[model samples]
Target: MAIFHTSIKTFSRGKGQSAVAAAAYRGGLLLSDFVTGQQHDYRRRSGVVESFCLAPPDAPRWALDPRELWAVAEAAERRKDSTVAREFEVSLPHELSEEQRAHLAFVIADALVGRYGFAVQASIHAPGTPDGLNHHVHILATTRRIGSEGFGEKTRELDVGPSGKVQVQWIREMVAAATNAHLEAAGLTDTIDHRSLAEQARSAIERGDDLAAAALSREPTQHLGKHAAALAGKGVATDKASTNDQIAEENREHYDFLVRKAGLEGKPAPVPGHEPVKRGGRVFNAETAGLPGGLELRGVSGVRLQNLLLSSHGHTPEQAPISLAEKILDALRDVEEISRARADLAMEKIRDALRWAQRQLSSQGETSELRQWVTNAALQVRALKSLIISRARRLLNVKSATRLRHMAEQEWERFNADCPPGSTRYSRSEWTLRRGRRLSVLEKHTAELKAAQERASEGELNAIDADILAKAELLAGLPHPSVSALRIAEPKPVPPDDLGSTRSVPRGPTFH
Candidate 1:
């Protein structure tokens, strides 16, 4: 299981620096600070001090401006020793839909408020152009505790003291758990605990590694020595040097030292290659006699076989009956597994092909051929369902067998009319089973196609072309089109009751 790490840090901010005030100013909302004894009457706009001009008139009256909140949090980080509020941003792997992102923000907000008793500042922002993703949310939370610790007495608020190092850890753990639970419930299993690395810093905090000392002791940077700006600017020049001069000098000095230590300066120079050396076959000399496939091996493994052929049958593995039988059996089992896997893959491919065809026929308004194709596809799907039921029953898995049987029966019921049906002016025969069996099937197919067309019109997919059914899936998915206007008849106004009796009936060309 993947784990999410947590951390916390705190700092004694500079004199007169108020995180709450900054947040309020950035959000363009009036805020009351109990510490400073200030309150704003929003109804009369009487205490509109330092309002954010950029804020829209109808914006929510939340005091914590998301931008200011983020800024304050980021600034709170301790760069060297002092406190600086800062924020950590994480990029999710999957692009969530707008609805999903909204849900995430709400869940996080609720969790924070439930635990801390203070509402967190939450906001969603759109990425700049070039990013097609539709989801990005930022959560800013107050560091101070609004009420008593609920989780435990040793809660982050009470344990961390003033610096907040302790709080970061608990915050990370709780947030990660909440996020993981939410995503898991929604079937979004592919996610990352981005805070895990930063949480390691909490241990440093416990060890009394103050912010200043921690800042001085820089992490061992990996990948490259230069910073991003330097790297992007240009390459650096290097001094030229001989490749082996230093190594040769060291070797000569070592040789002299060894000669002196041995007390034999005139000793005959050690033969350069006289030392006995172990070759490839030394390890296997006589230790493996009766072991399987180990006695006087001849060419057997692929590499050995190739080497023997290269050397004209010089090396081979000695094989016994048991070893050969084991190898053969292993190969057979692998082949069988591969065959089964291939069959499953083929079935999946066929299913995908049929679905694609259905979509294509659905896009092309209504046509006799399209209707027939749809009917055939539906029957094929039903047949596959029947096969599934039969297999389940044979396997003796009653639960699965019953489930498949139920599904098969339901599908059969849907195939009401014999095999065909009739057509009508207002609604096609497809809408009713009273039509002939043949017409009924045709009508069903026609109805499905019409539905598909409607979906396409609502910006679901491109007009499904015949080519889509036959061609390899285009890797580039389709984009939804802009919403189009639908024509609606406007109702005319009726004459007022008070004016009804005042109108005189005029006769054409008759003098009154």
Candidate 2:
């Protein structure tokens, strides 16, 4: 991808700048400043690949020539500290051919002319060195609108607090859009984004594309201008140059690590002192073995939690791919199928990592590091087991309760049809009492679910709470399901009724 960079600045006499000299240097021309009667000789200047001027349809003929245009621009501004011209400097992608680059420059120049009615003097500059990729264009635009009569009032809207910031942003976006369009037309996969790195990263993550997100998560380097760049080119380190080098290296390492971590690359990411462990003629992680994020004190379920988090973010469950091992286990009636394939691969990697840790404990001698690692690893493993068992139990109990509720409903239907309310089978008062007791138990489960809400993380809640919540609410909303009660807690026997009834409903159905 190409970098998105475009900037606007002004040549102000207050800042000791001359529009005539600036334009001459950019266009490789020799011209006199009509204002100061100053002759600026830049005809010997090299590296200019193209230079031209663009004017509005109603502009005077003199505005069409770079020399005449800037001369008039300087003459038009008379104050000692007057603002002379506005400049737009944009980098051109080295990936484009010369003709394409020139065409892009024309598009940008035409846009400026159409928007501001300014006479635009543009120069496309070659890189300082043939091997360099610093190809770019410099635009010197007049502050006033050009007409057949002459330069008119200054474009005050370009000031900072006014529409200036907005116009500059539009230019940035325009560069990005136009560059991408040309790249696509050229059949090049490279493109550009006008957003900041952080903004791009968030967008990628929101779309659930972590790989692209990882690439964008990197810190971008600072630009080194002419002097600092020259010094750095000669191998002298400057502060900015050093910082840029560090950022570039860090970005490279981070991207490489993420790619390797995500299993997009088979080669393990580099670590300062760690060496690859060669075993069975295969490369071993040496650190994680196969774990996601080497030595992380988390179980495979952590990956599951990540997927759950994604699902909780308004994404469909199918869009949040839980690990494949989970999928395979679910394919064994573990849970509903998820469509994501990335997590499935991550799951198998996690299993291998766990076994590796376990083997280390069995084979290696005791040490402080090993002890700490084992302690964390053991806790994660045990917690994972407990989590699995707890989920399985909850699912089984809810399923049983559902069936029992169904049975109870059927019994009520049958009793209502055949055995009337006043029939000898069961008294209306007794049925009402039993029904109230069942509702009380359902309320207990509902309370349990509600309480669990406070303790559960968003991940666990989405993964487990959804089913439990739905089932609990379903049972509570229905006429008390079972005669005995839900399996949540043991049922209390009914006390002696006023009619001298002593039979107790069996303690809630027991789950193995």
Q: Pick the candidate with the highest lDDT.
A: 2
Off by over 4 Å in 1: 1-94, 128-137, 147-167, 194-512
TM-score of 1: 0.26
> What's every prediction's RMSD, in angstroms?
35.6, 34.6
Cα lDDT tens digits, model 1, 207-279, are: 5543322332233222222243233223233221122335445545554554464356453332111111223
Question: Each candidate's lDDT (Cα)?
Answer: 0.35, 0.60
Model 2, position 144: C-alpha lDDT score? 95
Provide the lowest-lDDT 10-residue window in model 2: 333-342
Spell out the clash pairs found in candidate 2.
Answer: 323-343, 324-344
lDDT (Cα) of model 2: 0.60
lDDT of 2 by residue, 210-319 (tens): 66766776777888888887787455789998898799899778877775776755544432211222223342221212112111112222222223323333444334
